[model samples]
Target: MRRRTMGMLAAAAVAGLTVAGAPAAGAVPSAAGDAVTASVWRNVALTGTYTIRDDEGIFAAGTYCNGNVASEGWVNEVRTPSVWWETTCGGEIRVEKHVSAETDAGGGVMIYVTLRFYEGTNDTNTDLDAEYNFNRYVPA
Candidate 1:
């Protein structure tokens, strides 16, 4: 009888841990979002998307593309939103940049993104130009 009681207690403790607790210390979460787009100058048109999941924690993944760029990454900074990536499609338009989202007054989210082009050699020349800054608003 005593052995049965101890076995049941051990099982309960294992179940509690599996059901409750954060992921591993270095686990990354994801977010959900709707379809969104941002247009730059007449020379370039930017299209992007965001996804968020509000389960145990808040996580998000988003993407933006303009001309030769199709940037996609994930960010989860407490309550803020952000994204960044780099790509070399060769030819031209070697781009890397960041995206940010925040809560607005109307219970919606405001998204801001930037595109940067780098020119120079690694560890030798470090020169870059801010290509564009795009600000957009989306529904809650």
Candidate 2:
């Protein structure tokens, strides 16, 4: 009789649950309330090789917030990592990321980008023409 009563209570409680009692997926609780940030807004078109040039000791780079300012062929190295420009570039935004693979994949190339920006010693941030060749760019 006790087991039957407990089961009944449990079922009733579950059926009576409300939205006010449930949390959303990928939502972080703040002092204000549950909030979520929108991801994957602006997507820069990957065409040819994105160029990097040397200018004194800094390079010009920016994030693709609205739309990346591109020229003839290439723009900047637009990826998940936020890169900047200056004497070593003026910006203190840095983030770390990793990667994993699933089963049943073929052999391919792996590209490493050390200095995505220019060496910074040229006149302007154009014509220097630095390009990166990556095997694959797995989006996050």
Candidate maximizing lDDT: 1
Task: After superposing candidate 2 on the true structure, give the runs of residues whose Cα lies further than 4 Å from its correct spot.
Answer: 1-81, 84-114, 117-124, 127-140
Local accuracy by lDDT, each model: 0.35, 0.24
- Cα lDDT of model 2 by residue, 2-75, tens digit: 23432343343223322111111222344566665422221222221221211222333342111122211111
Worst 10 residues of 1 by lDDT: 17-26
Clashes of each: 12, 9
Runs of candidate 1 with Cα error greater than 4 angstroms are 1-83, 89-93, 122-125
lDDT tens digits, residues 17-103, model 1? 211111111233334345343211111123332211111111211222223233332222233434455553222223454666544
Best by TM-score: 1
Please report, as a residue range, the 10-residue window in candidate 2 with the lowest summed lDDT: 95-104
